[model samples]
Target: MSLIVQKFGGSSLANMQRVFNVARIVTQTYNQGHSVVVVVSAQGDTTDELLSKAYEINEEPSKREMDVLLSSGEQISMALLAMAIEKLGYHVVSLTGRQAGILTNSRYGSARIKSIETERLFKELDAKNIVIVAGFQGWNKYDDITTLGRGGSDTTAVALAASLHADVCEIYTDVDGVFTADPRIVGNPSKLRDISYDEMLELASLGANVLHNRSVEMAKKYGVKLVVRSSLNDSEGTVVKEVGSVEKMYVRGVARDNDIARIAVIGIEDKPGMAFKLFSLLARERISIDVILQSIGRDDTNDISFTVKKADLQKSLGVIRENLGMLNAKEVKYSENYSKVSVVGAGMVNNPGVASMMFEALYDADINIHMITTSEMKISVLVDVEKAERAVNAIHDKFKLGEINS
Candidate 1:
């Protein structure tokens, strides 16, 4: 029998009715002669509600304790799912991350999977039993419970697929599949039939919520095939696999990040080590900076701009202010008033006029591009938050992203 590992997001099992829906889906797959393993996140808003409860009691909760508290959500889901499957007259076993042999490093909020010894899973599968494993939580060497950061469930699902060598990893979520642009932003955005792992990684990093970045990276490393389909429908969804050749790739797709903010370090002496020193400070504090751009100075001083998550603005700005004297920057300016919009595709490097067309589209709409950063697969531009919607629409239309209406 072929092995298939499927993961369901919180939205997939938001209520009792939804939970039974998931059980039915798994039961149907099992009846079709496939060995099915299911991974599941918490019910809708369970993790968030737990976080709020913890914050109400303590302003600063210990990370280790927080993980212990948060993991309960997935545990609840797994047990409930097993019960539901049993009600459907199927033999089922549910295992937590540790029970399923998901060993991870002790990073508290963002642990990485070290190894997975699935001996028990094999035994269960051999008996024609459907195995249900909780996602987003793992055990470290010290036996301490750790939560993989946000969307870690996606990572867990893919990692398990790699370990089990399953034929495919199905990620069931609310959306039908990965789209050319967020449909809410761009009307009738096209759903890609297939995408390469590298292109998917770029899209996820650039703000596509269809899949998580860590999961994409893991999939690429292990050559795991992934499908992001909807639990609510029978759509085939987007297939993520190896690119046979770099030539067969799309030119551009929409990515928008509203959680990003711009940080401008003003009036720094135009010197080589200056940028290094500023970034070093942020690294020391464990603040992630994305999309950095440096501008030439009119005199001998330059302006350096970077983007960080809006949630980290206060702490990151404080760190910059503390190191201001060492950086020798005249002023540190921060604006939560900006957003990042990117066009991602693996073929971008050899695609002629891609950048020019992107700029021209924005230019035609009179949308000013404040900062720009490019990687092999993607180019991101920063603009005022108010103009983010306009920019996405303009680019989507310029590229003729959806099916052409001839």
Candidate 2:
């Protein structure tokens, strides 16, 4: 029998019926003689609701308190799932991140797991019990509850599988698997049979929303096998690993992220170390930056424009204002009406003209591109938010990705 680690997203266990459904899934796996360890996200919209409550209580609540509040969501899911499994006459135990030996850094709301103490987990597995562990959370060195950032549950499951040396890590979500484009947007986008870690990481990082990039990064590091499947059905999902044997497609899929904002620091002194100092201020606030563009001004000044998640716009703006004079910038401006559309595939690395084809599609669709960035596996462009869906569809059609099947 193989030891298996399974992670279910919130959409998979949103209600009691879904809870029972998930329990049956777990038990069925157990009946097949696989030792099962399940990691689950908080119930449907639980984290969002908790954030709303926290913001209602205080505009800027302490991160520590937020972590405590947010971490409770998964605990509820774990306990209910454990009870559901027990109802089916299976021995089960539910453990919090701490009880399961998950130790993390003291980053509170966005802590990175440092190490996992698997003694307790092994004991329960050895006892022939299906173990239910809360995902996206851990205990820090200060012993404070910490929540991994968004999509952290994926990381949790992958980390657990790596730690336990499980046969494979299965991530169950509402969708069947990773697709060429969001099927809802690009009708009948093809589902990928398999994807490589690097390509998947690029897609996830560029906003695929299937698997968290951090989880994929960790999986790549540890060589953990991961499968993305739908809990509602038994169809084969996507297999993510080191390599795929199929002939590589020019573009595997497209991802569009509308949660983007652009910040422009107008007329900053064009001097050495200015970029570093200015960005350092944002770093101090823990803001992540993306797609930096610097333009030469008429004289000893330049303009630096960059993109960040829309949610971080305010904080990033604040940092800019806080350091405007120090960096000798004329003014700071930002726009929240932009979207990031990306095309990802392993084949793209050795291929040329993909960018031109994407541009051609966008040109045909009359979608205007604002900013651009590229890596070996993907190309990302910023465009008007209103045209984001059109851009994605046009690109998907350009590659005829819908015709390619997993």
Candidate 1's TM-score reads: 0.96
- Clash count for each candidate, listed in order shown: 0, 0
Clashing pairs in 2: none
lDDT top scorer: 2
Query: Across residues 362-395, which tens digit of lDDT does each residue of candidate 2 receive?
Result: 9999999889998877899999999999999999
Residue 89 in model 1: shift from native, Å?
Answer: 0.3
Candidate 1, overall lDDT? 0.89
lDDT of 1 by residue, 35-110 (tens): 9999999999999999999999999999999999999999999999999999989999999999999999999988
Off by over 4 Å in 2: none
